[model samples]
Target: MKAIVIGGGVIGSSIAYRMSEAGADVTLVEARRIGGGTSSTSYAWVNACEKLTSRAYFELNWAGVKSHRRLAEEFEGSNWLHRPGVVQWQGAGAEAAGFDEGDFDKLERLKEWGYPAEKIDTQTLAELEPDVDLSTFNPEGAIYYPEDGWLDGPVYAGAMVAAARQRFGLKVVYGQVTELLTRNGAAVGVKLANGETIEADTVINSSGRWANEAVGNADHELPLAPTVGLIAYTVSGDTSLRHGLRTPLVNCRPDGAGRILLRANDIDKTLPFDTEAVPSNPAAQELLDRVTQLMPALKGVHVEAVRTAIRPIPADGYSAIGPHPALSNYYVTVTHSGVTMAAFIGEGVTDEIVHGKSVSEFAEFRLSRFF
Candidate 1:
């Protein structure tokens, strides 16, 4: 089968690689560089912890976590998936009240679901993350999930595309997709901004923030309530932080090298949803300040770069996968947790497209639900 995938972010790259591996002729089209979009700016936390909205969502994310392990085994020696685990604590300013009732309830729920979770006291926390300063916000304990990890999206995406090219002869086109060409109610191909038309038997829309634009004249609409996220990267410095950290003030993790990625939920709300540029200095500096408080070793570190990207969330805030409701040959795979779900969704979607086998787990996340 001939397949054309739009977007070169993590999702699109994964699908393209899997499809090519399945012996399908695949072409990947990217507007800019691979992973230059939302994938690059994402926190890239690979976990099922925050996916507490529903059991199905939770299971999907869990499968995603396992998929990362499989990918690591398959691609042995890749440094993209770092699974040192994550540690989270709860409290107010400069005072740790330990886990709140809500936090405890979530931990209990995770434990009941057979997820690896344990409460570690200050000493254990210190042992796990020796560089972190636990004096001011001395919490009784913190929750640790041994299975959680962080992904370097751009590195992974680039690796996948390179592997696909070397192993399966995947074709990659670098240009903006201007239209999704259709004939007789079936997707036929796509037209690039340079007026080049590449024909295909099937088209998969994995375009993150540009989903609607990729639809072109398909006579279907993808409802996306994308939100802007601001992430600040610190200058490479001396720091031994080994795990993803979630505290009351900031959420951070190692961003390869010696740089750390920092973000805060409260800071995200301060930015406008429609913003396309980097936020002001105050917002970027705030992330550095917050992380410095948590890790005093980063005291003299400066903000290296601040990236703002739109999170592609379906209207209801769940994944939308499967063939388009009205267009049989056009498929879509989009979600807010693209980093975590990319591998699983890529494998499952490939089975559905290449072998005509329906993925049972995708039943609740179909595009037809919204239509």
Candidate 2:
């Protein structure tokens, strides 16, 4: 079947790769450069230890983490994959929204849920990350996940698309999909911004934050809440970190080279909800200061850039995948943790599309839940 995959971010790149591998005539369409959108600015931490709300949701993210390991092995030469694990700690009060200590009793609950979480004291925390100021960062100890890690979304996406093109004859078109071509209430193709049309038997709307607009073009509506998040990149530093740190003030991870990528839920609260603009100078400085406080190694590291991008979060904050209820031959998959779930979701969704099988693990996260 001739399939057109929308968006060229991490999720779309994974889907395109998996679909092409399954012998489908795949075409990936992107409005701009691949992975230049929210994927580029993502924190990209692949973990599920702190998602204590729902067991099902936790399982989904956990599966994504494992899938990433498999991808790292498959693409052993790719420098974007880093599996150094993650360390997270909360403040004295209920400051963090999702990672709040009060929620589900925090570390105790994580251990009970069969998730690998180790409580570390200040000395142990210092041993894990010698450069970080553990006394000021995690005074009351912290939870560390040895299985967690991170990836470079843009680099991974670019690699996937390049492999798909060379191995499976995948066609990549660069232009905005202005409208969905339909016939007798079924999607047949897409009309591009340059007035070009490409016919396809099926179209998958994996357009991240733009998935809602893509749905609108197809004469349907998806209830998506695209929230904004600010990510700041710092200049390369001499001191290195062994794990991604999530303190109450800032969350930071190593950016392959010696640079660090920083963000915080507290800082994001001060910014607008759905803006495409970059963060202000003051906000950028504030993020740098917060990270430097946690990791004294980055005290003088310059803030290279700050980007504010709308995260692809469904209205209910769960995933919305599978075929559209109203539009035939069209499917969509979007969620908040796109980086963590990309490979797993892509592999599962591709099987459903090409082999006529349903991924049992993703049953709860289907688009039917919203409809």
Candidate 3:
């Protein structure tokens, strides 16, 4: 069977690798180079905090996180793995009603996933993190997730691409899928930018932000939305900032590097991808100033890198990862957390396409959920 995947980011590469791993003829199309989109600009945080608000999202992401852990070990030779604990910071009353410590049900939901969190006292927090000064922190406490952290985003995508093409014998096409070719309301193939048409029995819409466009959805039936995320690296290279000290994965307060990797709550949401946007957000600037108060080491750090990429956000607060409603042969798998959930998302999609297994955790995440 021939399967064509759109997008060469982590999600596309992952699905390509898994499909080829299951003995399918897989071809991936990318408008740009591999890992060159949001995946490239990703300031990844792979903590199990994606579903902190809802119990179900928490469970799904927790499962995805565990899958990532196993894949990290399985793909250890790629050197895309890192074990840095995620530090969730909250100010004043935010902690009480925040992503870190919002609800007791959320904690209970997390407990089922084998993630036991604890509130850290100020003195204990200071002892554990001597570099941070919580003088400005007015939170009741902070939650620590020992299993959460970040990784080399591009390296992971490269590793998946290598495994798919070299090991699994998948075809990696360095082009864009301009349109989805259909026959009798069923997807048959895709037309590339070079006008080359390749027949495909299954066309997976794994494109992160451009899936709908790839499938010719001018009406926008899907609930997908994009938000710009900015990444700023520090030139000082403070070793104190190496522990993956982050706030909430969806959206939290400023981080230790004096550079806030804004979460979903702080999302600069807008439709249609825009890269020419400037780096001037009052909230982000405030984040930088506040982070220095917490970590004095960032007082003199130079900004190393600053880039913006559109993050896909589903309306239901979950990813759309399955076959199309009317066209099952044409599937879609996308999310803002693709960096964190790529491994699992790939595994699940491959299971359905190659092994005929259903992803129970995300049954509602399919496009059929809306229709």
RMSD of each: 2.6, 2.1, 3.6
lDDT of 3 by residue, 325-363 (tens): 776588888776777788888898889888988988777
Winner on TM-score between 1 and 2 is: 1
lDDT of 2 by residue, 57-92 (tens): 887888887888898789758867787778877775
Candidate 3: where are CA atoms >4 Å away? 93-109, 217-221, 247-285
Name the lDDT of candidate 3. 0.68
Report the lDDT tens digits of candidate 1 across residue range 1-371: 99999999999999999999999999999999998889999999898877777888888888888887898789968978988989887766312222344347767888888778888889998889888888744466778988788898999999999999999999999999989889998999999989999999999999987988877763677888877798988889899988999887899998878989898877787888655444346888888888888889888999888888889999988899899989879999889889998988889989999989998778889998888
Error of 3 at 135 (Å): 0.9
Q: What ranking of all candidate models by TM-score puts the best one first? A: 1, 2, 3
Q: Candidate 1: lDDT of 116?
A: 88
How many steric clashes between backbone atoms does each model show? 0, 0, 3
Assess every candidate by TM-score: 0.94, 0.93, 0.87
Clashing pairs in 3: 250-263, 250-264, 251-263
Best by TM-score: 1
